[model samples]
Target: MNVSFLRRNRLLAGLFTAVLATGIVAGTAAPASAGNSHHKKIDYVALGDSYAAGQGGGRYLDECLHTKAAYPRAVDKLPGVKLIADATCSGATSLDVLKHQIPRVKHKLQKAELVTLTVGANDIASQEIRETCGAPGAAAPATFDEQRCTTLVLKAIANVKERVLKALVKIDDIRDRVKILVTGYPRLFAAPADAFQARANAAVDGLNAALHQAVKKANMWGVRAYFVDVTRAFHGRLIGDRFPWLHAEGNDTWHPNKWGHLAYSVVVIWHVKRIF
Candidate 1:
């Protein structure tokens, strides 16, 4: 009846159809990954922030903002992968992964053959994204009122470096040989719609650079770690695209919609198959 309700219903239906189709493919004919000797499933543990937690996708599984559409669940659907635990939460920072989420999943870490980390955004620029962006998706204000937001976000990233290392080391210590994939964030929009959008996109670039550095540092620490570039997840689908993968309403603004989650899942899955 109402516009919002109608749009909501349409989105939900689309998500349900997509997930169901994915399930069918997984259940009926998912192929084994190349490295697996006999289609042995890789035990995986996913950790990070809202991106990994599957926020703003379809439906919430818990307060952490996990949804069935998250990359971990999607990865699990592959014939050669099995999800052990998803110790991620919405709004989690790198330190939160180190001090809170990781501790709870120690045992899970022990058994995980693969672990993926998608954090650090919250630790650095979340405030600027939320307050400066004046949006729920943790982006710069719609009004672009904060000229200094980008600078602040860039400066804040330095703090997350050590925290990311700590989290990586902790995971490595727990699962000595487990392949660690620290994923980078995608640009929220395909192109810069304006100065604010351009700055916001640049902030994401800064975040990705920080993540890449953290991965390298983790390797120096003797951790079997790698950085995953996820920018391509939104290659042709951005805020102004005809088929944008991210939502644009209420608290979902700028967060990945189901299609965006699917794209993220594909990128992550590709890295897993190639690297792990």
Candidate 2:
């Protein structure tokens, strides 16, 4: 072997060893957080519905509707993360979070450095129209019945807004230092040109708009809350993305799949890094 070649190999080996040693030392010496004693370890309290729970996504834990790739689980993989991922069963509306999740969270919030919430879809009243009115061969609402569907749409939006506002109020009791991230829903229906489809999508958008408004109101009250808009994030990929996260009629398709969860994780982490 050429003498210079042998010397080059030795130099490369030494460099690799040095890098490995540095990584180990850094891992051991450094706390996961950036020197904030209060955030030495990330204590996350996750709240919300199926998306937060990682529904329909791949790699669910125990194959229960909740998947391992859910945003909370993804965040858990980050260095120094300690997560209390308590997103409940699917179909949980904002009211459920306030009446149930908030009470259960009081204990965790005492020490939590992060709190993330994803909700509002279940609060929408259009669930019945989507379930009952849109079925195959279901009688089209008579010209007279169109008003009924419209009525349901408006009622659901109003109720969802009310629930979202109440949840915002309850959020104030959580810890001050904890960064609260409120997430809006992704569009389940792709953008459509048909008049009826357009109207239906509008109802869904209304619910999401309410969610955004609620988060803003909470922020005004001095909660460290921010909203992650995922409405257009999945545009054009709904059908092409084999694992559609939208709940199919009757199945728990309303929740997110693994891919959908991953997308949400990206948005959440993007904002979360800003403060923490």
Candidate 3:
């Protein structure tokens, strides 16, 4: 066997062992809300990007677009749930969460019982799909670069994976008293009206896949992170639908509408309840 190959195999084996060990630890560890009662207030924090910030929902709390209609606000209404802080913002990437968003909630995280996050889309430049493949009246790139688009998306996925790992690790550091729930993006369109829409949907799928995998890996490593999929929540309400939940065009193009935010809040609340 090649020495380098042997080293690679050894590394893989070590990682697998570590994952299994963490699984065992997680299985035996005390529940996040072990002694908590219904009467106790649950310190909750929300963090992420436009989706979490409610960019397209309507009235904005600030330039970040954090809105009164955002899911976090809805979550705050739940019994025993207290909104500690919502650090989400429009156009925030994973790195932004690491630097800016996390700091806003870092101290709160140490005492939080629940933390909800919906990041990573901005990390992959989701808007590029609209600018490149889906730009109206603009000629599509040559067939030779079709694969290039795919490669670019793949590279973004890899970068997102690393960033997610780092973010999860940081969250875990302050999550001894918390349960973290990370959300995945919804598919951009239910059915492609044209090649542009098709390509955009595919890109969304890739981004969501990367997020799902990252959450799974984090759980396996005992990071105590869970993925809450919202893809299906917008099943019939994708862009181009008569009553779409997402914006088809405008400054908030591709972002969810108010109805979409309501759906997201419902899904998140359901998951939070299930976890506790």
Better of 1 and 3 by TM-score: 3
lDDT tens digits by residue: candidate 2, 1-276: 658545644653454344323321243433445334334376778888777877777655643367776777666545445686575556677778888888877887778877888776665533466543453334555443557767777777777666766765666565664677888876655655456556656766787787777767777777667777876656643532333545434455445554566667766665555555
- Global lDDT of each model? 0.76, 0.64, 0.74
Which prediction has the highest TM-score against the true structure?
3
Q: Rank the candidates by lDDT, best first.
A: 1, 3, 2
lDDT for model 1 comes to: 0.76
Off by over 4 Å in 2: 1-40, 59-64, 125-127, 131-144, 191-196, 240-254
- Where is model 1 poorest over a 10-residue stretch in terms of lDDT? 23-32
Preferred candidate (TM-score higher): 1 or 2: 1
Indicate whether candidate 2 or candidate 3 has the larger TM-score: 3
lDDT of 1 at 197: 72
Q: List the residue pairs that clash in candidate 2.
A: 55-256, 56-257, 57-257, 57-258, 60-67, 125-156, 246-253, 247-253, 247-254
- The sequence of per-residue lDDT tens digits that candidate 1 reaches over residues 70-133 is 9898777655667888898998988788888899999999988889999987865566455765
All candidates: TM-score:
0.79, 0.74, 0.80
